[model samples]
Target: MSFIGIDLGTSSLKAILVDGQQRVVADTARALTVHRPQPLWSEQEPGDWVAAALGALHDLRDAAPSAFRLCRGIGLSGQMHGAVLLDEADRPLRPCILWNDGRASAECAALEAAEPASRAITGNIAMPGFTAPKLLWVRRHEPALFRRIRKVLLPKAYLHLVLTGEAIEEMSDASGTLWLDVGSRDWSQRMLAATGLDRSQMPALVEGSQPAGRMRADLARELGFDSPPLFAGGAGDNAAGAVGLGAVAAGASFLSLGTSGVLWRTTAGFEPRADRAVHAFCHALPGLWHQMSVHLSAAASLNWWANVTGHTEAELLAALGETVTAPSPVLFTPYLSGERTPHNDPQMRGGFARLGHETGRNAMTQAVLEGVAFAFRDGKAALESAGGPIMEAVVIGGGARSGLWLSILASVLDMRLHRYPQTETGAAFGAARLARLACTGENSGEICTQPLGSPEIFNPQRDLVAAYRERYDDWQSAAEFSRALQ
Candidate 1:
């Protein structure tokens, strides 16, 4: 039987169709707009997510109707930290306040100061992206709307509600909301009191693979299939994406270079970073915890370069490929959307240093690649500080498609880089596997038995690693210098 996984991302929505043996049959995606109505605001129409998913499903059906018809289950993985409020009829109250939105700065700060109480309950320090801060922002500035909140769901859970008519969150997504008791995998009464949020407004919590509910027969037939069981409690995108990368064990790790970037390491137990720079979320794999260091601009910087140069995504990588040189002296700080991990400052900006007349777009492109890697190292330091061992990082994302970018990231990270055949489809593929287990009652880990295609490994060159060390030190100093600008 076929199973499908849908990834509700910030910039786009993607779907992956995979069969029993774990081979991806078809993958589809659709782009959506990110609205910025005011400064420091990022919003997206929650309906756009459903529209994108349906559009991709239509495309998938057209591509492989028979396989789509045979699909037995559907799972969702979505961008975490987005607050999507629903009115009494289960309609969105307003556009979702995305993870990148910085309007909750004050709330985050106050919560951070109360870390002892906050962490004692929520299991992590407050950040601007967590749901409670955004809810507080609404309560203070948009009280009328906050008063109308009948339900609050993360990005993917919102989509799941639309698809299955059941609105509930899984532990993985719940962990990101700062309302979940991470240690016990339940809602925190302390957090509810602090945020003044009615715990009833939240959905019934379930584990990631737990059955949310079956798909509506009418909706399923309308879309092209018999009603299949739908798993509600899917996962936060990063955690689900880690499942896609097979980073299930404590030592397994992966570097995802999507529109944004992340360095994720898996552990069988929760190890919250001491500084809380790295996010500590429940893994899609039950009984495991995942720590992630996310960068706001990974390939987004390269994408901007591609736009300016009028090069297609393929051409941009091609140009970087032909002009292979030892890592360029130019440095890039990919803070286009401000940074998340290591440096939690949202006021930071992106830049290129040591740009001489000879420094062409290729060098600039390489800088963007290496610069993201440098930023990732900051999170690496945080995770290491928490006593997690750094191992070779499996690389996944659109940026990983760039051979030069992958090699440079490996060198800068001073680790081996392993690329999967379906890099871009990691989340969907992982979601598919999860869905299959939920549907067929199959062993989930069996999906990992087959190694992901022929992975190209990039080992760091000693001299380049030494040079990157010096460059990294300078990068950190530059970030400190820029902090005063805020």
Candidate 2:
């Protein structure tokens, strides 16, 4: 049998077909738009996700008809922490408040004020990106709409509802909402009440590898499936990617350089260090938890630089030429969308420092790349400070495609980095693995722990590491100076 995995990302919907042998048969993605009605606000129509998802599935079906027809289960992964409020009829009440939206800062403070034990309970600092604060934002600003909210769902859970007619959520995604009790792995009544919500408005929780429900008969028919496909609860993108990369075991970790940068490490038990702003949450699997340190921009800083410089990413990366003779004098702080790890400051902005007559496009580009690497180092340091070890990390995401960036990251982090054969397919492939586990009742460890195809390892250069250590110190000083100006 074949399994289908769907990743509902912030900028696109990606679907992949994987057979029982764990080989990807076909994959497709459809672009999605984020609606920004106001500054620091990010929203998306839930209906657009559903449409994009279906469209991507259609593309997959066309590409691999037999594999698509043989699909027995479906799993979902998505951007976490989005608040998708629903009415009594299960229709979305408004555009979802995305994980990156910063409109709920005041609400975050209010939540902490109302629930003093919130950090202990949720294993996280109250951030505007979390669902609880977004709900509080609605309750305070759009009280009428808040009154109409009958249920709350994350982005992927909304798709689950659309496909299965079930209001269900999985642990990994729900953990980011500040509603789930991270230690207990269930929704917290106290946290919900603090946000002016209750159990009734929450979706029934399930493990990511468990079956939430079967696909709706109509959806099955529309998609040309022979029978109703089993739906696995799946996970948030990072957790799902972890499963895909076989990072479920304790100390197993990976670095993702997508729009945001994340350094994630799996652990055997609940570990919360809210003081560091390090995220402590349940993993997709039962009895497993993970800690993540996040930087708001990684590859995004590169993308922005490319856009502003009128150069393609390829052109800019090509300029690196495989060796680092010296560090760029120009230091950059990559706080383009504010920051999370260590400093949880949403008002922070990023820019280049120490430009001179000698500074050119190449120097500026190198600074941008090195700056992102430095920010990720800060995340790694925070994770380590929180007692999470960093033996090694599997690298994945769009930025992982750049060898120069990976070299810089490895050197700056001063840790070995491994690249899987299919780095870009991490989350979707993981969703597929979850589908297999849910459908076949197979052991999650066995199903999820396939060797990444002869992984390529990136080891740090000692000289470069030493140089980056000094550069990192300077970068921290530059960051402090920037914050002082704010």
TM-score per candidate, in order?
A: 0.95, 0.98
lDDT score, candidate 2, position 442: 91
- Give the Cα lDDT of each candidate: 0.79, 0.91
Candidate 2 residue-wise lDDT, 1-486, digit = tens:
999999898877888999878998999988889888998888999999999988988998899998898799999999999999999999999999998888898889999999999999999999988999999999999999999999999999999999999999999999999999999999999999999899999999999999889999998999999899999989999999999998889989899998888999999999999999999999999989999998878898998899899999999999878767778989999988778998898777899999998889999999999999998888888999988469789998889998888888899999999987878889999999998888989988888884547988889999999998888888999998867876
Output the worst ten-in-a-row residue range by lDDT, candidate 2.
Answer: 444-453
CA-RMSD of model 2? 1.1
In model 1, the worst 10-residue window by lDDT is: 442-451
Highest TM-score: which candidate?
A: 2
Candidates' RMSD to native: 1.8, 1.1
Candidate 2 global lDDT = 0.91
